[model samples]
Target: MSRVTPTTSRSIGQHTHDYAYYRTVLANHALPAAFIDLDHFAMNLERLRQRAGNLPIRLVTKSVRSVEMIRRILAAGSFMQGLLCYSAGEAAWLASQGFDDIVVAYPSVEPTDIRAVATQLRYGRAITLMVDSIEQVMKISRIAQAEDVVIPLAIDLDMSSAFPFIHFGVHRSPIHDETTALILARKIAEQPGVALQGLMGYEGQIAGLMDDVPGEPVKSAVIRHLKKKSIVEVNARRQAVVDALRKDGHTLRFVNGGGTGSFESTRQDRSVTELAAGSGLYAPTLFDHYRAFKVLPAAGFALPVTRVPKAGVVTCSGGGYIASGPMGKNRLPLPWLPAGCRLLANEAAGEVQTPVQHALSTSPATGDPILFRHAKAGELCERFNELLLIQDGQIIDTVRTYRGEGKSFF
Candidate 1:
């Protein structure tokens, strides 16, 4: 497969035509009813690869739930680095699949998952467990010691705007400030069995926030301001904590930061050794709002047009698959192509059908494909059993998601 580039309005039309052919082929082959354009996916990956430059991107498995797709991308180029997993079970599963470098993004509360991490670590897998508090440390340590296992660990620092108030981003990690982060780092460093490998800071406001959109200018401005403040304050404070840890004789191996959206800015920071990226693999509608760079709409779901009540409204079968974030119309699946199509006010995305309002020049007949891209990437895969990999407007192969593989790690 050749490297694909980012799509514009011109190329997107061609992609649509290509998708029609791909889906038709799949239908003829008796395959499951889902499609993924590999050409677009490859282009999306390359777009991220070019944007990231020299910095290696840790594939966010949560964004791309298909293990085979992850493997396929990893095989694409060496620029792709390690897996940034969401769950401990995912890390363990990836480790079993011969993935050496794996970092569990969130702290694992499940004892069974922790034990699995310990087992993977015991067998010489480079799996890093993310910890935020001493309580978290104690919890994992107890399980580790009980299993007589020694493992590597990374401290998760809460990278959010903390100027006048704690009013931005997700309230994830407790280690936001230098003092608190250093204290936790010290505790982890003192732990005999576990090794403090590095620090992981996720700037969600800068990385995940949508900077561009048609309306909501004031909200977008606020998000941009928060992101600017966060980059300056968080970077300084995070560096301070790393310095403090080193000053106290801690040898930090790596400092991980950023996501797919903020790769360029994060890579400029000398403090961050490696940047995290996963969502770019399948550029969702939420990511479409960014102004800095453009990525291809790699992943999408086609729900069959099941209900058409009026000349202006057409409802599709099974489209209630919404992404987890602030709920609004933006969270709903966007109707791509044949422009002027929008989601209905009463029912945004229904369980069985989503009514869309559009001025179709030629009234769309029943069974006409309504391609909808979710606001977020991997979350969409969870709703589907398999992804149809399309190459050059053709269905080349079909791959199973974690759901299809019977591994619900989440």
Candidate 2:
């Protein structure tokens, strides 16, 4: 099932029909239900492949919570290798489900999750724990009976910025200095049973920012500048860190970097062997901000209009599917179909009955479907048990989410 690259900007018309199908399928279910359009989802997946050029993509499960969807996308190509999981519990769950190479992208503080991951190492599931400090190493080692029994690990270097007052990214990974990175990599190398496999540095500031968007010019300039600076600075530093670590006598199995927005740029960096991407598959709202690519809105959540506040105002139940990030206008969900709607300021998104102001007011009556795009994807999918798989504008089948499977590793 190789990804079929789109040759034009037009959407696969199946999405429109998929919308109708879900209206009927989730009719009995609660309002404000969220789901993915498999057709568009597939297209987005293929688009990533086209954009990736020759580099392999590691699916980020945190961006798409549906395990079935994850497996389905991986089935599309052998090119989609491994997963950049967010939690140790999720890593263990994904591993048990038969995914061998799972990288817990962020450093974990949960002793229970760490122990759960350690328990899976006995089954030959190769889980890579991310470390930036010796404390993290000590924490994982203390949970397990022996450090040697712990699964292999990778080092996460902070690639945000080099110069003070010119910060260009997210504040992550304490191993920012090449000297510190080398020392820590050496320490991990010395630890028993823990193999120092790779290094990961995510440039969220550039990869995640939506520069070159039509309206936000000033902000766009800053983003573009920061991105260019971050790439040059981070790439050099990351390579230096890798070089220094190797000089200290460490074997680098892999050096993972990049995100959905950074596939091309990250691939351009000779030091980064493989990059991770998950949000691009589903084309979450956050990805809409990227200047490099335009992924179709594959995943969307539908909220049923339950109230007619006014002739112009239609309200849907439980609109509270806000994305987790800096709180602002962008954190709120975007109005998708039946345009001309805006989220209420005080209550950007509501728990139930989210009022919308759209020109297509006549188009939607009580019980009519109004599609809402989450500012971020997957997080909304967690609220739903199953996603209606729509193909060629029809409901092909329904698949269970990780939540529907009764798995909540988060």
Candidate 3:
């Protein structure tokens, strides 16, 4: 694996000190507000490109949840090629905004969404749908035929490893072997209105799992071993599948793989044409444990201290913004900034109030702002309508999230 050099000049300690800066900028604004630091966001974008080397990046829209932010990343340059939308309806919505070269990363069973995508295809938009079964292919084929347009399709391959007693990845895509992939490709090729366009395989165990977690050294070591072996196996399987499809006379336009955590390793694979990433842009708390690269904390929210529960504890209003994943303490929002503050064990991150205990020399006063980082990136947008854009200690812009635009496609 190639070594990744740290790019940011500021350390975690420096970032904590910037709490004063955030307070100063948002002094006149309301509490329980979310913001993005453009300087850190730009730094992270550059680092993602560097890790990708020469390969193109497909921005994952689900991790951003903002059309304006997506447009900004695409306008950055040619390094970003297209979007990997999570929902078929969202893909059509982005298409209506004049963005092309989109691929729905998940399968859709909704007839209305299928018709919407077909309409975009008829209007000369480059949108591809994902399928792992022939049933989904036939559904899309019927819609394409009815609309009198040829829709593009991509195959989703399962890249997880099955050990004797352990399954080491996400449960997605039943098509694993090369034979299964070739059979599906042939089936799509025989269809009248749909054509094979791409292949997508996501190795979530290697890409999403953290290898440098703090407490469990033995568990972290085991996870690292599993990731190393999974990488080699997945690459070989992906290559074989691609070769089989080509031998069967199917020409695939693109092969997408990887995520924010696996960019360095995934880019080295010869079979993958493009890599998908987006969570790294926000640098949430869950992404901080990776050893390959260090990302800045670009996104966070501030809540107001409403009361002093005790000498060492301060209660803030409205914090319980937990992240989506397997249940654990890691999914809770982290009490960042003001350096040494911590969440109380008895009542950690409540819906109406959160009590924080600290050992700093100065105690938190009523009406003071306390900053925190969410466990995941775009999920923060679900709680707030808009994100205040901060740059160099000033609010430059306020942009709407998907929720703010009255759009929610789950």
Looking at candidate 1, what is the lDDT of residue 147?
79
Tens-digit lDDT track for model 1 on 1-410?
A: 33334444344332334434534654444322556777677667767777887888888889999888888888877788888899998899889888889998999879899888888887889988899889888888788788787767898988777567556777888887778877887888677667788889888888888887668788777777777777777778778888887887878888898998788778767778888888887889988878787767778877776778988888788888887878677788787744677888778888877888878674666777666788888998888889877776567677899999888985
- The candidate 3 region of ten consecutive residues with least summed lDDT is 1-10
Q: Compared with the true structure, what per-residue lDDT tens digits does model 3 show for residues 1-410?
A: 11112344342222433768888988889998999887788778888888898999999998899888888888877888999999999999999989899999999868899899988988899999999999999999998898899989999999998877989999999999899998899999999999999999998998888898888899989999988888988988998998888888999999999999998778767899999998998989989988788788989999999999788889999999999999988999988877788898778999999999877575878888888999999999998999888877898888899999999997
Model 3 has how many clashing residue pairs? Answer: 0
- Structural RMSD, model 1: 3.0
lDDT of 2 by residue, 71-187 (tens): 787787777888889899999888888887889998886988887788788888888989889988877766664534766789998978855666667789788978998888778
Q: Candidate 3: lDDT over CA atoms?
A: 0.88
lDDT at position 276, candidate 2: 85
Candidate 1: regions farther than 4 A off: 1-32
- Model 2 pairs whose backbones collide: 14-393, 148-192, 148-193, 210-289, 316-353, 316-354, 317-353, 318-351, 318-352, 318-353
Clashes of each: 2, 10, 0
- The residue pairs that clash in candidate 1, if any, are 4-43, 318-352
- Assess candidate 1 and give its TM-score to the true structure: 0.92
By lDDT rank, best first, the candidates go 3, 1, 2
Q: Give each model a TM-score.
A: 0.92, 0.91, 0.95
